[model samples]
Target: MIVTADGSAREPNFNRHITTPNMRKKSINMMYQWFVVSLVYYGLAMNSANLGTDPYISFAASAIVGIPATLFSAVILKYLGRRLSLSGTMLLAGITCLVTALPWPANLNWVIVTLATIGMFASSGTYGICFLYSGELYLTVVRNIGLGSNSTWARASAILAPYVALLGMYRREYPLLIFGVLAISASIAGLFLPETQDQELPETLEDGENFGKKQRFWTLLPQKPSIDNNSAVEQ
Candidate 1:
């Protein structure tokens, strides 16, 4: 039984979760974000060897950088809120990926490696945040279904990432270029999603539909009490 907005209980209907306007919009946005995050994360890892560095070193660096990035993501998610944290990391990844694709002097291979590593770091952070953010965005009644669908999209993108990397055969920058564009686009899409930090998770269809309705596009942090307002109230 699901408790609705009006305090009535009813059997959960799976179809309503998908058909509702707000729920549908949020799901689409999350699916796109998941797809891009998976593609870039896997794509960069797969193409690390082609970034003008030793394959073993590049691969190992990619694996190791994720640790600090995940920690940084946790810190930012606690303060910056889900929408900003995800979008900021994705935007950073996108910009770095694009910069890494730029033609540079052959002697500057280390520069390429550095930029690629940063992109990987940001992508890694975004990947970790998506798991928590998606859970919060979904209604409790269909949370599992929502997460499964997003995961399916992510896996599908992962499968296609190798093909994206293969484009590097024609031009080494092609893979990063694609990944960058997608990440930037996903970042923009993420802004439209409601910030879920410190907010109650929706349990019913009505709750899902109404969730975050009051927030504007620029609202990135949780609301806090104003000192002036509190002082005035005390007076």
Candidate 2:
């Protein structure tokens, strides 16, 4: 066992981490977010062939969108902060998925493909943000445990993603509808999490518990320095 400088044993207390109300809520929220994001991300890719476009083109479009989506995620995380950026992308993805599942005329197959492409774009961005956001949410003591648990949820969803795509054989809309509902639900769950932008990482369990307790729901953006205050200081 590792001992701290104070000569106390540094064994991680998994029970305390899981049983604490705040940490527990954060874990549940992140689990759902990870599951839904992974499900939608992989589901969209696998369901590409059913988008009524050339399978090759549809697949390529999904793959290529990841570049811009990741860049977009970086911009949003920097400006909008973690909570809003994550939920916003997931919400956008959910809406597009729901629209894509609508029954449109065959002539409007292009519309379906377009919406699906947009969903893919948003899901990819959420996927990138989740990796960073999860780390910030957990205390350093159990950070590895938290991330590993979230990754397990993601992998479980990925395993089921192919089967979700297979639902397309019966009705192409079924898979998309499922993805849409879950993404939206996850977005709502994500909103309960506190914004982590410009905040110090939680280094202890107590720190994690109290991190975002003071934040209101509407506080989604990072706090910027007041230009007037800066000018006054300079003067």
Q: Write the per-residue lDDT of candidate 2 for residues 151-184, one digit (tens) a residue.
A: 9999999999999999998998899999999999
Q: How accurate is candidate 2 locally (lDDT)?
A: 0.90
Q: How does candidate 1 score on lDDT? A: 0.91
- Once superposed on the true structure, which residue ranges of model 1 sit more than 4 Å away at CA? 1-19, 224-235
What clash pairs does model 2 have? none
Return the TM-score for candidate 2, rounded to 2 decimals: 0.87
Native-to-model Cα distance after best TM-score fit, residue 53 in candidate 1, in Å: 1.9
Superposed Cα RMSD, model 1? 5.1
Candidate 1: residue 40 lDDT (0-100): 98
Q: Could you tell me every candidate's TM-score relative to the true structure?
A: 0.87, 0.87
The sequence of per-residue lDDT tens digits that candidate 1 reaches over residues 1-235 is 9899999999987775345898899999999999999999999999987777788888888889999999999999989989999999999999999999999999998888888889999999999999999989998898999999999999999999999999987899999999999999999999999887766778888899999898898777766533677779999
Q: Candidate 2: misplaced stretches above 4 Å?
A: 1-19, 224-235
